[model samples]
Target chain A: MISTASAVIGSRVSVGHRMLALTWLISPLLLLATWALVAASGHYSAQLLIPPADVWHTFKDLLHSGELLEGAAFSLRRLASGFVLGASGGLLFGAALALSKTVEVYCAPMFHVLRQVPSIALIPMFILVFGVEETFKVLLVTKAVFFPVALATSEGIKAIPRSHFEVARLYRLPRYSLLLDVVFPAAAPPILTGLRVGLTRAWMVLVAAELLAADSGLGQMIEMGRQMMRIDVVMVGVITIGLIGFVLDSSLRLLERRLFRWKAIKE
Target chain B: MNASLDQRWLASTSHSPGALQIRELSKHYLLDGQPMEVLKGIDLRVKPGEFVSIVGASGCGKSSLLRLIAGLESDYSGDMQLDGKAITTTSLERGIVFQDHRLFPWKTVAQNIAIALKRSPLTRQEKALRVAEHIRLVNLQGFENAYPHQLSGGMAQRAAIARALITQPKLLLLDEPFGALDALTRISMQRELQRIWVQHRSTMIMVTHDVEEALYLGDRVIVMDARPGRIKYEIDVDLPHPRERHAPRLQELKEILLTELAGSDADK
Candidate 1:
């Protein structure tokens, strides 16, 4: 069996198992080097052209003052509440749409139309209805998460091969057992991918919503930095946001690999 | 070993391997509002512990016939029964393997085979033991943890066969179970299937386009014709288990079957 696997997925294990390659750092280093060169070249004013070192100093100050942690915690808390509720709701709704002809016929067109309207465009109405507080930000995040996750779940369930259901019937698997043993496993890959996509998109929307109006968040910190003319503080917020988003997405991708290791088996 | 439980399973399996009886079985489908007949008034009988093979050209509905027996479809008008029980919905007594090895991709080989026992009366320990036993039966001991895609085509098919049989079903249906294989793998799997049949002695019915495969494994071969499918010929192999592949008798029968099949093809 190992031989057969090796024959199909030859030598990829070596490349795939590494956590990080030295080559991955080169691009980031190059970007930083270019930024430093520009800062030293002295084209822009000191305010506009603060060096990477100044951003690092700002990063340290935020870290030491606990502002960064507080802001990050607040942002993440909102994401968690919104994502959990939205994703679970989407999962249930998507499953219903996939499993029931009634749901598909009645709800699919409206779902398609609603998902097309971007969450950012709904902010003014959302502000009026839900107010420019935590409710507004979380709802925007939930909206961002719901549509893609539901779409993915519905399509994923529909994509499961009919023959699998036949086999389930042949063995007379009970309804719940059929769902657990066959249906869920087949649809899991796509559903997980949808979650990753939703979470990242929600993060983007939540940040934008915070920038528009929020008491405390990473996005609000960036907004404050702009008002205070602290370019270094703005850079700190920007870098943290980018790094956090990358970490969230990368971690989910890793989780997907770990969960679906069997998928590596070639057909 | 649980001697009494093992004895019960053996007795239930060998003493009364299900007998399949079919009569006036015909199936049709509505193709864009037109009723298209796929099988026409077919009749077949499979005795207990019998290995029956059905062969036909495309559109012969040999597969549909097997699916009907497996109770995968119910729209057909017919008398179909296993051991005097009228077939209605899918039953655990009738297990099927398709041309594709339908081992769940997410499952390991052991897990795949074990799923067949989800509704079995066996205790968890007995189910595990039986799964291991079937793994051995299919010569897949070392591959038990391997996923389907990790297996070679032949290995995957053997795993599928193991899954089909682990239920201790009265009748196992194979719809071109080896049609996806290369020549070498096909021959080896046929030998493996024959050996398993000799050991388990459960009733099996296989459908294949390969006349040689049908003749090699089957105690009796039923040739079918296409376009409103009907059984055209039945040839009994008057041979024993572990029949020699290169035997003069098999070769002779193959010649006759091929000539009849060629004649039917010429008419097309």
Candidate 2:
């Protein structure tokens, strides 16, 4: 009886341990096979629905010609610049709002209204204002990134328990250390969630901005491909943008897991 | 070990004033435009190196009294002193361990303990040593890297106790520190606390509802009554440290405290 119970527990543990890796590949592999089969069945024209082989070839050609690599690098550079500017500003502004009632009362309503305006919807307005240049793209992406991070940061700071603040006061923790040690660490999990949301949204906004107007970048590549009726190239750009965004999000999640190991294993 | 009880505590070494003093302390909360009194005209004194446990029925403001002493509540009208200084706000010299282990869930037990020492002037090595010592003092030596959620109820409370003690506070205020623990764990923790009190001999005031616990640990037990809470009775244990679980004197005190709490409940 004891051995049967032990066997049950051991099998459950083994299955649970391997679940993540197994789940990761299962759906994507299934989708790839289904796509390959549907394309082979010739239900749609190749132009309208390229086969997996055609997409793969276009991907290889772009990589070999270094177009894909350089295009992605430029897009990444824009993302990095805009995200840094927006996220940092958002962090500071959010903390200020949390700490000062005047800032909250003054800026909160305006910020709320502004955030409701989609960054994509502002593309034409931004183009007219900034002349379809890199400034327009960066500023649009910044708008996309800023609000979520700021709102999350303020909410995170506010959510910290009164007990922790009392402990901080008892220890005579100074302003700088109080922020660095108590406030930051306590607020970090929620802040990281905010950062993750901001990052994905910014990536989407960058692609959208490039779609509207840009000399280069993955979204521009797709836009140019669409205008010229090079559907395979458009497909390549779409897949690359998606893959990069997925990778960035997954990496942030990895960092969150490492930083909050104590919270992770509990769930 | 027996003689150490009579020896002066190194922390409050010679000529130290009272551990704590409260003079006519009262608190009123504005509830729905009505002034609700919590603590009323309470005067108490705790000598240096003494242990006191407070027991009362629910709503007796026992926890509020501890919070007042720990400087968590400052809006009260009273004179509260620690080491002969006025208590206006929280100070490291006065530490508190709550009923729930308030260790940051993201930090390990060691990190949680070390956080309390961040403002201290101790060196990195000294800080690590003090954390390790306190972890060991709470009998949590092997679980330094364990998170609070990973620990059992008893262990988490012990870690909380360790964090409170790491500062070497002049007075430690505990509000039902073991109230959440299961029966077996509570007994073990009481023994552990007794051992630690014998070793450190710092002034500790614990608020509890357990009759046995108040009798076992306190040098003096203060029983409180509700409806604008004030002390109804005080019992001196007059026993040495590392007290036995089944001491006759403690059992007698337990009956007296149980009667007091029951009597107050009956009145309500």
Give me the candidate number with maximum DockQ.
1
lDDT of 2 at A50: 81
Measured against the true two-chain complex, the DockQ scores of the candidates, in the order shown, are 0.72, 0.62
Model 1 in CAPRI terms: which quality?
medium
Please write out the lDDT profile of model 1 over residues A1-267, one tens digit for every residue. 989998667657656656355678889999999999999999988798799998999899999999999999999999999999889889989988998999999999999999999988988899999998888888888889999999999999999999999989888898888888998789999999999999999999888888889989999999999999998999998899999999999999999988898886545
TM-score of chain B of each: 0.94, 0.92
Which tens-of-lDDT digit does each residue in A1-267 have in candidate 2?
999999999999999989965898988889989988888888988787888888899999999999999899989999999999899988999898887899999998998898898888898998999898889888877888898899899999999999888777767778997898778888898889999999999999899888878889999999998999888899999989999999999999999988987773733
Worst 10 residues of 1 chain B by lDDT: B8-17
Going through the candidates in order, the fraction of native interface contacts each one reproduces equals: 0.81, 0.65
lDDT of 2 by residue, B175-226 (tens): 9998999999999888988887777778889999887898889999998999
Those runs of model 1 whose alpha carbons end farther than 4 Å from true positions after fitting are: A1-20, A265-267, B1-15
Error of 2 at B72 (Å): 0.9
Report each candidate's C-alpha RMSD, comma-separated, in the order given: 4.9, 4.0
Candidate 2: the clashing residue pairs are none
User: DockQ for the candidate 2 complex?
Assistant: 0.62
- Candidate 1's C-alpha lDDT? 0.90
The local lDDT score (0 to 100) that residue B233 gets in candidate 1 is 95
